[model samples]
Target: RARSRGRRCSVTGTPLLLCCYLAYLALGTSVFQALESSAARDSKEGSKSDNWTSLLNYTCLDRQALDRLIRDIIQRYKSGVIFLSNTTSMGRWELAGSFFFSISTITTIGYGNLSPQTMGARLFCIFFALLGIPLNLVLLNRLGRLMLFWVQRWALWLGGAQKNQARARWYAGSFALFSGLLLFFLLPPILFSSMEGWSYEEGFYYSFITLSTVGFGDYVIGMDPGRRYPVWYKNLVSMWILFGMAWLALIINLVISLLESSIVLCPCSRRNPCRT
Candidate 1:
């Protein structure tokens, strides 16, 4: 009877948890829009004013001509022609870029910087992703478990057998989280900042966003056409992204385990299995 009642409570609580999650998302959306919308509007207006002033000062073109020029540039940019540089011989559809795109697609980190334009290519992409995404997920799951095993071993070495199993697990989780932050979040940003000419903070933000698979497309690497990059650059970045994502997955799993264990140990949970 008790087990059946507990099961019922657990089933009922799921909807309540889902409602709370939706409400949290709503709160975040509202706060972000309120904070950013005004600044975005102001920036847009300022940009228009600056463009007009630059056109008037530096060129003989009138407003109508400027508008036409802007339209033409936009058209070319949308067609992916303007992305090619006169000085650079590299094209977006090259092998290295395609490899990077494939990795990004399978990892669900579609940066929206590059995409297939042809119908056939798009169809292929859909089929490729259908298979590759699951394969990538399976690989990451195994890698996460391997990483967790190593983390536990390190924890045991550090804390020794005198520590309780729970304490050892906590130590392992903490160590994994800190190590991942340092390797994926902190150290990589320094290199990115130097290589990309971005500020440290921007590099850190990009690392976090990319590893989280948000892929906002604001700060993609190796997209600049004016400057030449090494041929291996994109491949190296793809490798970094793969490892960082796996590390992040491991950290997330550790966090979820910790949360579940904490809930199981809660005093209210002992009295009511579905109290959460």
Candidate 2:
């Protein structure tokens, strides 16, 4: 009975976590839009030479020191020691909303809607992913199992038969295959073909190229000339890519666990060793 209750808690917790993430994304979008507008207003009112874009010059610090600092910050975020603290006064609830942003970026979601604006920040991100990628994989593996276990528990709690870990692993695999198909075959063509005026094959290829983080930028979304929708539409596309990548990593982890559990040794080889 206790196990059943625990399962229910886990199932409920997953969506609650996702909801909290979406709320954070919304807050970030608002804050960034406000900041950009304020900067634009300031630029227009000030002297022509005093452009807001010029404020980005890293003259105060030499290039070498700036590079070192960026590397340090990247490492800190990767180790989970640093978090993104919002500068604007959006209150504590909004500040908490930024945590989802931190988690996604550190995991290399690279939503592109929100990104490191400064050269230092971008350089740090380069090295941050170098160290964080493997560590992220390790954490993902553990989380996948925990997620599946909870899902199984929730099912049993609802009076369904509990699926064995092996069976759960298979289901996860099947879901991953389905996700890949939708992503690599269906979604890109349907969404991008009309916008890019490319064939369905080209659209499908573009989807894989983006989700894989190749970022060739040759066929990036919203790069199409005169594409409609405000900045918010671009942000949504970025979030979708991030979510898809997260799901891909989870599925890969499940496949690994399944393979690990399926090892076997022949009984004849063990019992007739003396005959050899």
List ranges where model 1 is wrong by over 4 Å. Answer: 1-11, 56-72, 86-91, 159-170, 231-233, 255-276
Model 2, global lDDT: 0.55
lDDT of 1 by residue, 1-276 (tens): 667766676676567567767998999999999999999989889877986788777878888897898799888776666544452332377776687788878999998677788899899999999999999999888877888788888777766775577787787777778888898889887877766788999999999899999998889887666666776766667777888888988767768777544543232255655433
Best by lDDT: 1
Q: Least accurate stretch of 10 residues (summed lDDT) in model 2?
A: 265-274
Q: Which parts of model 2 have CA positions greater than 4 angstroms off? A: 1-176, 183-185, 230-232, 254-276
Pairs with backbone N, CA or C atoms under 3 Å apart (clashes), candidate 2: none
Give RMSD to native, each candidate.
3.9, 18.8
Clashes of 1: 0
